[model samples]
Target: MKARTDTKEKIMELGTDLVESIGYPSLSYQQISSQLGIKNAAVHYHFPSKESLGLEILNTAIGSFEKMISNISSLGLWEQLDTFFKSYRKHLESNNKICLIGASASDYQELPESMQAAASEYLVLVKGWFVELLREGREEGVFHFKGEPKHKAAVIVSALAGGLQHARLVGNLHYDEIVEQLVEDLKP
Candidate 1:
């Protein structure tokens, strides 16, 4: 929309990175502008408010995660689980950033009403995917867990989220242990 023609995209890219790397509440137009070497008005021009930016990030994250889950839908059960675990691990390489789900969730109370709704939608989509995956995997004898799929899925998701946060304070070993034990515990 400007001479750069990708300023809006760049803003969104940096915006989300900041949200995941730092917390969403820590994100600021000034911080974004400083990182992108643009003026604060440049960010403001595209996103009139922080809520607008947060909403856009959540929407984009939902679409991205939907696509990711679908892409791995054809894989073997264990492979699919490995891919899912890898997604969370990828963030550990980048300033101890957690997944967007965890980042947005930590700020849920501070989010605007619309942002909160989007966050809830994101949660449902992810947890639903995990629940279905666990159900199918167990039915196929790929997993040997002893709880309702929904309950187990919630525990897995929450542990991974918390593991990422804990990784930042301690080290990645704690995160790796969580992933390993999760898979081990689900073994046949």
Candidate 2:
């Protein structure tokens, strides 16, 4: 049972990387199976279908987002904002900035219904978290953006998502500059 669970997790992790880099249409059971040193039948045993595997990958992303939110619960407003910003930087610096959600969102029409719904849910949740963070940060004078918190949140989310793609092309230093500009722009 433990081995089965471990193999399932390995599939999800590798599947996530494949999907993030190549998008859903390019991901396949054979790729995951070959990469993980397993048979396609084993992959199918766990996921049963490509749609199931795609849904699992999205669900994994949702779980990671939830964990990120929970991990920052004790932080003050400024620190929380810093942590949020740093999450993207961490990914960039690690050279893992290619985002599964970004790829999923881009390939939305190609996805199964379950995967589409899950991807949408992840975006909505992330945007909602940013809205709350920006709202509270403004109330406490931690952020100085002029506009509705929801609007700023949307802008930030879109910028970071777009910035992630741009970084993959223009390089990390440029990406860091964009993030620094965002931080400076929000200063009171």
Candidate 3:
């Protein structure tokens, strides 16, 4: 039983590495098996199908982000918001400045319904954090927004994702600058 579990884990790990390195659509099972030094049938035995493997990769990626963000601590609500954004920025910098969840979420519609549902859950949870922070900040007089908190949260997430894409495409240092500016904009 333990050996079976380990094999499943190993396959999932390889799948995640392939997705993060080459992207989900381009990740070939045969290539992953070659990298794993195993027969493609071994991978197929564990995953049954490519969609299953993709779903596992999606789960692992989202789980990793949740674990990373759950570690931040702050004394006050505003400080919590600051810590959240700052920690996220640091995560981006530390992870080669890549948006893992956002990248995976982009391919959700193309994946199976199970994967899309998982992706939607992760995205809604992330958006909820921003919404909570924005609402709390406004309540405490630490933030002023012209729109609803949930809408503001959506804007923040979209802008951040858009800025990252622009930075990648334009080869500019303005990405971090834009994120920092948004942090300030979230202030009262």
Model 3 per-residue lDDT at 121? 76
* C-alpha RMSD between model 3 and the true structure: 3.2
On residues 82-134, what C-alpha lDDT tens digit does candidate 3 reach at each position?
A: 66556545534543343545666666556678877776777787788789878
TM per candidate comes to 0.95, 0.94, 0.77
**Maximum-TM-score candidate:** 1
Clashes of each: 0, 0, 1
Q: Put down candidate 2 lDDT per residue, 1-188, tens digits, no spaces.
A: 99999999999888877887778999999999999999999999999999999998888888888998899968987787788778766666645446766888789899989888998999899999989988888898888998999999888888887787888898877767777887887889
Winner of 1 and 3 under lDDT: 1
The collision pairs in model 2 are none
| Candidate number with the higher lDDT (1 or 2) | 1
Q: After superposition, how far is residue 178 of candidate 2 from its true place, in Å?
A: 1.9
**Quick one: how many clashes does candidate 2 have?**
0
